[model samples]
Target: MHNINYVLISLLGGLIVPLQLAMINAFRHTSGATQIQSTFFLYVGGAIASLVIALFVDGSIKPPLYQHASWWMWLSGLLGSFYILCIFLAAPHIGATNTLLWVFLGQMIFATMIDSSGFLGMQIKKLDSLKLIGLGFIFIGGLIMIYSEYRHSSS
Candidate 1:
């Protein structure tokens, strides 16, 4: 399944998110575009780019099997829309590092639950002490980032 390729691509996507968010925020400043307007254009651009890539990579486009899909599948984009909105609002106020620290912490906790419980068709994995320790470290690091930011702002 080209697991290594998937991992590399996923890591690259993760690394790009902060940079993209920062750039989009800059556009909000320079272009006088509101966050919602910027986000709308961002998704418009993404849709066009994705279509271009799919035309090459997919070879042939086919309709998705919507009959077999759950009702929630249609609503999934709402989550992304909310996340993008929050990223635009929070990153500017909190700074990217602090904003992403909390976001990553939330993602890690929910992802651990999803992985361990086999939620949404994922393979079940035991959540062991090592996993707990890793998550704990992440939580502590996020707290530290928040505290440091608060202290600096207060002074």
Candidate 2:
């Protein structure tokens, strides 16, 4: 329950995002496979590994509250599929740095909206000017990245 532990775990999770995308992009490129096909195996491998871990840790395949889960709870698979497909399609052309920069920026903007509105069962967290200014900084950074990429390509 300590804040330090939570932050460490969050840092680890954050560190994995770009690495995961890079691995996915590399796999797609080397295997000469379609995004859907590559993404399918990624899901399958994740499911298998998760199942193994769950069985060892919890000693059961089913969650305690599976019966009470809402239909929307199952949509993460669809969302993840689309996310992977987008990264796979975009990373090769734009480079992973630019792709992840824009992705993180979008996440910040939309997450601010989601948090402020308390959408989808999340707790309401009001956004302030500081948060808006932070978002502006992120947008400006992405614009600079895009302009740089454009100039490099045009040259």
Candidate 3:
């Protein structure tokens, strides 16, 4: 574990995320594919790359099938697929900045409720006032983006 440089790996992965997002939009336009289709291709490409690295660089042959995985893990994957599909379809049209704002706002709203856990049928921690204020700020920013888009489109 001490030999592993996790900080460097995380930094590289974080930097690549935005470049990958840009490529998703660019390839969608260039290849005449819908953004959702482009995103699916990108996910496939990423999976292949990750498999190669894990097999060669890490020299790991394989892990156990569904080792310690619960049904929730599979459900999470389905949720991720839908979330990615929605964002890819909407992001290009909204502009990345605006999309980011709206997505963040939505995430904050859901996250607050999830943290409270009453609505989701879970027993998670409750949110504080600070978190509520932060959620409010997120929505305010989203509204600003919407207003900006409305003004630009109308004019």
Candidate 4:
């Protein structure tokens, strides 16, 4: 069951990502929107889709907007916009594969640190030396990919 879930998760996310890239590329060519703008539009479209589902399927038209949230919590959209902007800008210059390597490495580094320390209310998982070294190796691999891209571009 765990393997099945993993396969399904991979299949769904893999399918969505290429579709997103195509949409981003099309938006870039058609609207001349900045990367940031395209990402915002993407989220906007997602929000619309969610609204339709909620209204027609669930009969609830809105999230509990009345729920409390910190300023930073509400600013997640802005943060995501910045991240997507970086992704679009980087992916064109560096190949998508290389860009993803950087993004994944960054995420791994931050997530591992947070999870290890129980930061931000995450359940603490003490990072043994083995895990730390393994993560370090992953980060090094990502750096190598970026370096390869740099070298290729320079040549």
Q: Which candidate tops lDDT?
A: 1
lDDT of 3 at 110: 82
C-alpha displacement of 39 in model 2, angstroms? 0.7
Taking the tens digit of each residue's C-alpha lDDT, what string does model 2 give over 1-155?
56998899988987887888888777888998788899898999989999999999989986558679898898889998998788777887888888888888888989999999999989999899999999999999999999998998899
For model 2, what is the alpha-carbon lDDT of residue 39?
A: 88
User: TM-score winner among the candidates?
Assistant: 1
lDDT (C-alpha) at residue 117 in model 2: 98
Q: Residue 74's C-alpha lDDT in candidate 3?
A: 69
**Candidate 1 Cα outliers beyond 4 Å, as residue runs:** 1-5
lDDT of 4 by residue, 1-155 (tens): 65998999887986776567767978888999977778878889978997898889988765556458555667767777777778788887776777777777787788889988898689998878898898789888988887887898799
Which window of 10 residues has the lowest lDDT sum in candidate 4?
Answer: 62-71
Q: lDDT for every model?
A: 0.89, 0.88, 0.75, 0.79
Candidates ranked, most accurate by lDDT first: 1, 2, 4, 3
Q: What is the C-alpha RMSD of each candidate to the true structure, in Å?
A: 2.1, 2.1, 4.9, 2.9
Q: At residue 98, what lDDT does model 3 achieve?
A: 74
> Which regions of candidate 2 are displaced past 4 Å?
63-66
Instruction: Tell me which residue pairs clash in candidate 3.
Output: none
lDDT of 1 by residue, 104-150 (tens): 88898999999999998899989999999999999899888888878
Residues 1-155 of candidate 3 have per-residue lDDT tens digits of 68468988976875764576677788888899976677678778868988898888878867648968776666865676676777676776787777656666777688778878776466787789888888888777778878988999999
Clashing pairs in 2: none
TM-score of each: 0.90, 0.88, 0.72, 0.77
